[model samples]
Target chain A: MAEALNKAGSYFIGLVRVIVMRILIAEDDLDSQTLLKVILQKEGHEIVTADNGLAAWEKFQQEDIHLLITDWVMPEMSGLDLCKKIRAQKTSEAVYIIMVTAKEEKQDLITAIDAGANDYITKPYDKGELIARVRSGERMVSLEQELINKNKEIYSEKEKSEQLLLSIFPRFIVERLKQGEVVADSCPDVTVLFADINNFANIFSRKEPVELVEILGQLFSVFDRLVSAHGLEKIKTIGDTYMAVGGIRKIRRL
Target chain B: MDSNEKEKIVVSVDPDFEEIIPGFLEHRREDIKKILEALDGNDFEGIRIIGHTMKGVGGGYGFDAISDIGRFIEAAAKENRPEDIRQHTEELASYIDRVEVVYE
Candidate 1:
């Protein structure tokens, strides 16, 4: 649903909305091409046509088609080859392919399936059945798209969690935490340093929250570089106070 | 066997297709001329393409007989059966002549 809105998108009819797919028809026959367009267009779909498989492939490359309806046989490239090409390319999302075949070519659908068609409709197609299959394709396309969107959301959320973890913990600690470890560290014979910014209370009272955050961020970044330069590990920060420890690896002079 | 139709062959089409039916039928009418031209030149591929097109679309618009004739024409053309192609082409011509469309 989110994916549909992202891509040109579904339509609301009257009070209810239906997904209006951007469909591509790849048939060499002009009559069939126009007829398919007319039938699908009446359903409020956006229809585009290619006279054969090669042209269809070109169009598929140029645009984001939600569904593809292709005839099995044609000049240039056959629909089977076109399906194979589409399936072979690693697309971020799916495009549902409905292969249109002559009734006699029904036996060849195993081949069509092997070539990567998601569905089949026989020639001299029944309008009801044709629309049904296209609807099925739309459902599959929308679901696959929804799944892709969900995976992306999961990845972004995971990144956010990792960023937060890294901000609180040291690199090794964060790495170990990511590995599902319950971490405890022993640090002895180290010099501990703590510093607090002067007039922080006055600044906090005077500045906006956003401005206060920016000022602290800049000051903390400078302090972090200084700590690193002095061979100290930043322990943590509390309000305007900064903390660090030297010789986390070994004993060091203050 | 071509001239026995005193009855009107009325095809009931969906109202949604009412707009394009005239143009669609006219396109099929032109196919007859093209089939004849292709037949004269032994351009079997050309005839087969025309037949293949009609075969795919005729029934979609409530014209099954046109699709049948188209299939017959395509098959006959592929097998080098000139007589069969001519016969089916005539059937196509006849069907187009006698057919009437009423939107439902």
Candidate 2:
């Protein structure tokens, strides 16, 4: 039973992990197109094919493409042009591009890199090498997505911590504390208010400890809101007594 | 076919080559015809297009010789050298005619 349960759990996790990437292949030759499609499909990537660079650019605009494999020469536009155009687009996600061509000259490689190709593969490309390069591209694309998710998580954590800090202190005081500044201040013009709950001993004597504490809690919360509405800074709550201050502080010049 | 002729043109590729070799050879033959017509018409631009296409597609299908010849033709066309382009086209045609595919 335990073994079967484990199998079922893994199967469910596998179902949730279906991150099949969308890859665009722009090769004019039918044979080369078929070869690339077959290889990438076998690796579980969804393929979108175009016969020329112009068509490839169109498909890229229409779809959420994760990767591109393009031949250098085509009818309408060359692969280098397509690479430049794709790079110029203001897309939110980075599209990994691999230029596949027969040109193996160092200058050709430099041109491809300068035109914004992330990687280059020369023909006749070895099947294993092609797959390995594509796998590397996949790793890079996924790493970028992982970094984006981590950043979002960090932002959310920061917001939560800020909320917790705000609950403990006033906003200005929290800012000063964050800046590592001393919080001592002498206010020349200020109003200090203090309030104490009356008949506190009599109320405590009549009620259970828990009930009395609950009552005090509700009463103090009301006072806290009132202090904030009146634009006053709450200093501290000492048992039944509440203290707050409103002031302008002047720095003493040495 | 003669053993010498067969040995002259060889395609060393993976098993997937079997599925595409026939079509690839047919395409090369068509490209040869186009190259000849472009040469006869002195249409250097047309020749360059065909050469560029071959250069891109030939080696991909285990025909590095075709890619080399195509590169020569493309460069000659860019320079508008009819004699050099014709010579490269002749070499390309002979290479295609003598070619044989061997799957690894």
Candidate 3:
């Protein structure tokens, strides 16, 4: 009998050390918090503890907490509130929240679920049950991490697509394309026109070289508009002279 | 409709709104506010500067309607034609009123 009992004790001990999860325990009671931390640490899991939900949230933001083992009630915020906040972020990879409550009624379980907890463990709980619950939570955390990785990949791909779109067209055109607009087709009978600025050298003949460039920019804005108004394509610009072409859709050269 | 015909149709059926209505509305409102302020001050030079910038930017975005209005404003400002600018300003305001930015 003694040998069997000793073997069982060793087996339970081994089970605790084999599972690796970073758990954050939110319990206001000092002794309870320490006990839970020690229990989880012995199981080969890293432990973080907060006396209230607010502190837990702060810790959550600062670190990658895989599982939350929180009391049902605490100062600052309740465990339910914490779970709700975590789920709402959607940015959080996925976290397994197991509410540690003294309540045993069906209503309590319903409340926990509504608030986003994945599981619940009753107080005065059996050590074996506690360990089993945690192990299950580890599985949930792994699944969540997978989802997080997938979301990251999607986000990165979206950024790359935006960059490519920006390079190909102006931001407005890119936005139109993103909205599913058919804007790239050629306009039928669209006339393109080009115009060159008059007096290629005379406009800047009397001004300093640097001032000439600045003045030219202000002056050339006029021609740029006239061409745009007539739907003329600006083929190129050479110093004081600007060249634009008209007749793209329906050839009407001007 | 076949895939090709469906693809030919503009993504946004609304001739005015092409993409992200709320985003564009917010941007245009802000820009129009600045243009109005510049106009009120009898600052044709400032009007020309602002209108010219809007013309290029609006055109690039495929908001041809807004771009054309911006060009009109730019032209009037360049020629110091106050009456033409006043008429274009009203047209621009009407365009803004016509625009409906869908939240969805």
State candidate 3's TM-score: 0.45
Model 3: how far residue B20 lies from native, Å:
61
Tell me how many clashing residue pairs each candidate has.
Answer: 0, 0, 15
lDDT: worst 10-residue window of model 1 chain B: B1-10
Identify the leading candidate in terms of TM-score.
1
Query: What lDDT score belongs to each candidate, Candidate 1 first?
Result: 0.84, 0.80, 0.68
Fnat per candidate: 0.71, 0.31, 0.00
lDDT tens digits, residue span A45-67, model 1: 88889998899999999977889
lDDT (Cα, 0-100) at A199 in candidate 1 = 81
Tell me how each candidate scores on DockQ against the true complex.
0.66, 0.35, 0.00
TM-score of each: 0.85, 0.69, 0.45
Which regions of candidate 2 fall more than 4 Å away from where they truly are? A1-21, A28-31, A51-58, A72-78, A81-94, A180-182, A188-245, A248-254, B1-12, B81-102
Worst 10 residues of 1 chain A by lDDT: A1-10
Model 1 alpha-carbon drift over 4 Å, by segment: A1-8, A11-17, A186-192, A198-211, A230-232, A245-254, B1-6
lDDT of 3 by residue, B9-72 (tens): 1222232233334554456666667767877787888777556545543433345566677678
Q: Which run of 10 residues does model 3 chain A get worst, by summed lDDT?
A: A2-11
